[model samples]
Target: MKLKRARRSRRGRIEIIPMIDVMFFLLATYLLASLSMQRLDALPIALPDGKTAPLPSAAPLTLSIDRQDHIEVGGHAVALADVGNAVRQQLHDDRKVIVAADDKATQGTVTRAMLAAQNAGARALLIVIRHEG
Candidate 1:
């Protein structure tokens, strides 16, 4: 018989532990980044629900109150006394006015505007809110 052929023990494939370690490291990194970006939002307001028909898209009169409590309509500053007369003349019949009040403004100011709009014979008075944005 010929000389016995030399045979070496076979080596199996190595387990991929480094791949699992990399996957876990990537997961941790994403989790930490996502947590850092988390932020709180403002309180929610509930809108009324009903099966109402849509209103026409008429251009609404916008009234805004600044931090100093000054009132402006259509980007023009006007005296509080003249608001009703002015709105009455400008608005057409069957249209409502929009009052946009800032957080710094008092409730009375907004209420006064609404009351004025109503007194001027506005069909409806709507209070515009920041939530609309």
Candidate 2:
């Protein structure tokens, strides 16, 4: 039997064009994702330098308003009418109150909580908001 010469197989080559296309697609996707993460209308806030500031005499009181208009103080739920009394009970020499209201919370609810804090003799009131990126 006559032996036939074996043909050499073609070597596989890496396609740089396809690799470049894939890299560009990934870059564009990441760029768009980063752009969308930015908040356009977010207000810039300058925080106080704590190095020279006096230390707080006491921890700040945290009060929260939920979307359902429920009021919470120190992780305990309290009635809207009783919010002032509850805050008064927790007040010490420092009467600083921080109100954290949900984005979906109604304006009336937030206003009521703030009023309660004021009625409870809070000297300073601060609203807590989520920091935008």
Per-residue lDDT over 15-88 for candidate 2, one digit per residue giving the tens place of the 0 to 100 score: 99999999999999999999999743222222222233333656577787777777787667888898999889
Pairs of residues clashing in candidate 2: none
Pairs with backbone N, CA or C atoms under 3 Å apart (clashes), candidate 1: none
Worst 10 residues of 2 by lDDT: 41-50
Q: For candidate 1, what is the lDDT?
A: 0.66
- Candidate number with greatest TM-score: 2
Residue 13 CA displacement from its true place in model 1, Å: 60
Candidate 2 lDDT for residue 89: 89
What lDDT, from 0 to 1, does candidate 2 have? 0.75
Q: Pairing residues by index, what is the TM-score of model 1?
A: 0.52
Residue 71 lDDT (model 1): 72
TM-score of each candidate structure, all chains considered together: 0.52, 0.55
